[model samples]
Target: MGEQRKVLVTGASRGIGRAICNRLHADGYAVVGIARTRPADLPEGMDFHCADLSSAEDLRGLLKKLAAQGPYHGLVNNVGLVQSDPLADVLLEDLHRAVALNLEAAILCAQALIGGMREAGFGRIVNISSRAALGKQSRTIYSATKAGVIGMTRTWALEFAAQGVTVNAVAPGPIATEFFWDANPDRDATTAKLLAAIPVGRIGEPDDVANAVAYLLDRRTGFVTGQTHFVCGGMTVGAA
Candidate 1:
């Protein structure tokens, strides 16, 4: 078994983030979870540090302190927020919040952690993107910010690749998570369409995405940097 590797997962209170933590922990990684709220119950030996990713100062402070205390072997950027308003109707505050939480904070965290990772000569940075970032509609604000994340993934993949650090992105289409309902309280009808569109004919679960993340972090997948893997039941292929 590999020695317990150090990993830091953002937005790990619940849903996909929580699942990712569980997966890595089982694989013998020392996992630290960060979120606005702490989960009621997590695996034993798990460490959690709560912080608001939307705040610039909070983002910088938390990441710097964490890096000082750790030569983290892995970083998972899973924290994100969405705005349900149309381009013609989005508010400035919501737009700022979307970009801040989804893209800006992620970039800052990497800036603070990448140096340590490089010095350690090994690191795994997984940017949790969305198929919505690839090509979608009516999500102008959320899409723009998410698309930036994909770009960041590609750029950093190259920068970290030769340094023994692997940077990749996993864009999940739609999984049944608390954030989904929070974004669309009346979006249940989209389920049938989603399942029909997915070749698998089933909506995804947290574990499904978590499994994909685990694979990308595999030692053998080191050569797989700068690639965005879609864990959306082949949504990247087509809806048909």
Candidate 2:
């Protein structure tokens, strides 16, 4: 594959982002991976770009470089941050940072490469959100940011529909990744409660979410934009 078939994925060093990169690469697309730290075990054929997405200036500069590369075939906004803080104790800085990294970065990154997609008349954009966006006790800011991502996904889908560009969102729930373990430690009652609430009776793997993203990015799914694909293992079926 060449630049015409290139796909950019942020937060590609770990978790769902890494899985998406691998899946797209396996599907014969040139993968461009972005993250603050480069992973030692990134898959072959995947190019890495290191940058802190939380910094607006840094993210803009990175996008500029990516734009210079020309016409990405796909974009996966899988970079995000989650913080568990009660409403009263939540810091303004935390909220601002969450909005910047989780929401703003995705929008800016999309704007950076959408022009080429428009000219080429084909593109796939996937924004990774969280089931917590529905509502969660301690994830107020995080949920808000993810919810904002959903809104942008819908709007972009409409804006680019006629241009042959599709925009959609994937919301994962209770995925068993390093980020989950680091945020909610094992042996905690809250963790147990979350597990019990999952109708699957098991935690989801990063590949579960990755597979859904791959489907949406497929050329066959060009008619499936402006929708939120919940990779939540049936957790969103009822009041869990």
Candidate 3:
């Protein structure tokens, strides 16, 4: 590659975010990783930033710094907060938290970076949505916000098409990240039930999702915009 194109990835401390950073860096992109805390094992030469995306003050400050340092060529909105609660028991506070991190942060980040992209006439944005957006029990808030992400992706894709930018989403089904293990602890009935619902027979991995994000963020992918690619092992269609 000539000069390395710069990309920003949120929730980059571990799991899918970390995998994306590693893959992009290996692919010769200048990767900037953002998360609430720094990871000790971040790839050498990769930049890391800490910011609580849910906090408006923190996000504003971080965005300002990133703008000054950026003109970044790509962005991966991967930070998300999931509050799994039944509709009857859902808390308003959890809903707000989910909206702030899962929805608002992505919108604001794109708004902050789109101007530079417009000027440069090149950019890629990949939002990490969820298969649950299709409708899952106890995912009311998450589904709503993720669905909103898809809406934003489509709208932004249309708005930015003429400007040489593309916006898309990667909706992952069940991935075996720390969050997944935490939510589905013991290899018990719940875990078995969940596994039975996946056509692939095994849960997905972080790299599986990272690969999808990389494809969407590739410069050559400009024509593939406003689409939601589900990396759900066929769960989106139906169980095997």
Candidate 4:
């Protein structure tokens, strides 16, 4: 496993981010788990970095520290946030925070690390987006940020392809994570509505999304950059 190397994952304390960290670590990579609050909970052998993704200053410092450690074989952007309010009810601060945490942080984080990935001449970046990214809706603002990530993935794939850095995105539908259910406690109705639209008839797990990400970022998937794979239990195709 000499080729096994360091991999960094943001929002690595829970849900899909945690699953990705575990999967990569099991696959022999040295995992760097990033989370503003939960860094201490990360498993052994996985390094931790604390930083609030919504704060540009904090993000800059985190990236600086990460770069000082040298090249990474992979990077996973799994941090994002959105308000539960209706569009009209969303405060200006919430709007800024959503876009800032979901999009700006991603862009800055990537910019900070892309150089080392390029220098290594071998890199993989997996961006985690939401099904909302598929189209504009009442959830337009959050969707916009996620959509931007897909755009970034495509552009960076082209920009870094020749340098051996492949960038890709994974869009997931509503998952069965506790955070999601807690955010929308009308649990039964939500599940019914989601399942009604999805052919899979079931909600997704963090592991489902994690596996998809692992594939795209795997060295064997170098030819798979600039693409976004839908990890949405058939939701994206209107099968639900």
lDDT of each: 0.84, 0.90, 0.88, 0.81
lDDT of 1 by residue, 54-142 (tens): 88898798888888885878889999987776668878888888988999878888998899889978888999988888656568888
Clashing pairs in 1: none
| TM-scores for all predictions | 0.93, 0.96, 0.95, 0.92
Q: Sort by lDDT, best first: what order?
A: 2, 3, 1, 4
Give the lowest summed-lDDT range of ten residues in model 2.
Answer: 231-240
Candidate 3 regions exceeding 4 Å error are 1-4, 238-240
| Winning model by lDDT | 2
**Tens digits of per-residue lDDT for model 3 on 37-117?**
999877789989988988878888888888777588899999998778889999899999899999889988998899988
Per-residue lDDT of 1-240 in model 4, one digit per residue for the tens? 333378888888888888888888887888888877774456786788778888899889878988787888888999988556667776777778888888888888788888888888899998988877876345666777888888988998899999999899998887877667765564477656756777788778999988998898788887888988898888778532
Q: Order the numbered candidates by TM-score, best leading.
A: 2, 3, 1, 4
**Taking the candidates one at a time, how many backbone clashes does each contain?**
0, 0, 0, 2
Question: Which stretches in model 1 have alpha-carbon errors above 4 Å?
Answer: 1-4, 184-188, 238-240
lDDT for 76 in candidate 1 is: 93
Q: Per-residue alpha-carbon lDDT of model 2 for 22-124, expressed as tens digits?
A: 8898989899999999999888768999999888889898899888878988999999998889999999999998988899889889989999999999999
Q: Distance from true position, residue 161, model 3, in Å?
A: 0.7
